[model samples]
Target chain A: EPEVTQTPSHQVTQMGQEVILRCVPISNHLYFYWYRQILGQKVEFLVSFYNNEISEKSEIFDDQFSVERPDGSNFTLKIRSTKLEDSAMYFCASTSTGGDYGYTFGSGTRLTVV
Target chain B: KDQVFQPSTVASSEGAVVEIFCNHSVSNAYNFFWYLHFPGCAPRLLVKGSKPSQQGRYNMTYERFSSSLLILQVREADAAVYYCACGAAGNKLTFGGGTRVLVKP
Candidate 1:
């Protein structure tokens, strides 16, 4: 089974710092997404990317957040200025079809903003 | 204003079946999904409950406002947090507070 790969399994950063989380979606997948889960909370959608551009984003994805498909296989989420509340587990997912189809999620990157 | 709701935890013995119940308030929801998550790992789609489907030992029954996931003959490895979500507007999913399953040998 092909897997979506994510870098930096865990990261700790000071508040107000910039952070970029990287993901390599499944080779044949067309849609990519970023989701976050605060400790003991349900997962929340952040953004969805398709055709090299953002398709949809939630209110949680504000000016401080941006997503880019920097290359053929790499999709990244950058937080311009991390706040303490930004601490959470960030998961990258990909699907061959629309998101209503099942999505394959990568082992999340734990971001701890201090 | 929670769109999804589920139990907090369930304990079961090995070889027993476990059922997790979920309810949603999203009136426009046409599909539901179930995901399994181990600590420190990404949640994996266990069953897509668009119209009630089964995969391996996992089965899902979906209704307009509620759904349930059944794990048949569960094993120790089946212990994990299970999440139920409803597809909302913009193709995004609103997840319920996950149910943690504890399986005893």
Candidate 2:
């Protein structure tokens, strides 16, 4: 089965540093999303992208955070300035068609801010 | 508030049967999705049900107020954290806290 791929399985960075997480969604997928989960917590939606523009974003996605579909296949999330609270597992997902069809999630990037 | 609820953990023997439930409060929810996640991994879709009837080891039933995921048979490989998510008209998903299952051999 085709899969979404996320780079940097694990990353450690200073609290004030900038970090970029990359994801390559399925070739045919039209929608991409970024989600995060703090340890032992429920998954939280960050942002959703479609047609090269942000479709929806949660309050957690603030000025420090930005997402871009740099190319047709690559979607990225950049944190301008990281905070200790930013440490979490970030997931990337894609769906060929939304609604009843479930989205496929990548393995995730474990971001640890010191 | 709209939310999904699931047990924190469940334990069973290797060959025992287990049912993991995901109940939700989203009144506009049109579909319920079940996902499996191993430790240190991302969530993987197991099944999705838009209506009360669907096929596969995982099945779902939707009511006016909630939904559920029913796993009929269990195996060692089935031991993983399971999450129940509800998707509304916009394709946004609200996930539960997830239930951690441990299957002892």
Candidate 3:
């Protein structure tokens, strides 16, 4: 079965550095999302992308955060400046355009900021 | 505020009986979900969107237990971590940390 795939399973970056987390969504899906889970915290929605544009975003997705689907299949989330609070597991998920289906999520990329 | 919860936390049961897992949420979210994960692996789709499916004794129920996945006549292979999520309007999902179940021989 097709599944969302994320790159750089783990990353370590210093405060104030930039980090790009990449994901390749299932080929046929249209809705894409980025979520993060701080250690011991619930998953929080960061942003959603469709048609090469962001559809919605959470307050947690502030000025320092951005998402781009540079290619037909590659979706990316970039953190312009990392902070200690930015340490978390970032997950990418995709759903069919119809909106009735569940999301398929990648294993995730663990981002660690020091 | 939105929250999903599974109180059992962990379970160890025998391989031939039914195990009913539970999920609760402060969210009156219309959509609920269940996903299963094997050790060292990512979560796999099991059931979603208030539609519960029954496959060889795996039954998902929405009306009761807030949302639940019932595994009948469990097997060793059924041991895994289970998670539940709830949301309204099919928007963002609020997931519970997860419940771990162990089916013994």
Candidate order (lDDT): 1, 2, 3
True contacts kept of 3: 0.37
| C-alpha TM-score for every candidate | 0.94, 0.94, 0.87
Which pairs of residues clash in candidate 1, taking residues 3 or more apart in a chain or in different chains?
Answer: none
Chain A TM value for model 2: 0.98
**Candidate 2 runs further than 4 Å off:** B53-55
For model 2 chain B, the run of ten residues with the poorest summed lDDT: B63-72
Model 3 scores what on Cα lDDT? Answer: 0.78
TM-score order, best first, reads: 1, 2, 3
Q: What RMSD does each model have against the real structure?
A: 1.6, 1.6, 2.5
lDDT, candidate 2, A1-114, per-residue tens: 898999999999999999999999999999899999999799998999988999999999999999998878899999999999999999999998765688899999999999
Against the true two-chain complex, what DockQ does each candidate achieve? 0.62, 0.72, 0.46
Residue range B44-103, candidate 1, lDDT tens digits? 898885688999999999888889999999999998999988884347677898999999
> What's model 2's interface RMSD, roughly to a tenth of an angstrom?
1.4
The predicted structure with the larger lDDT, 1 or 2, is 1
Docking class of 3: acceptable
Per-residue lDDT of candidate 2, residues B11-82 (tens digit): 888766677777788668868888989976768887776677545777677765566666667788888899
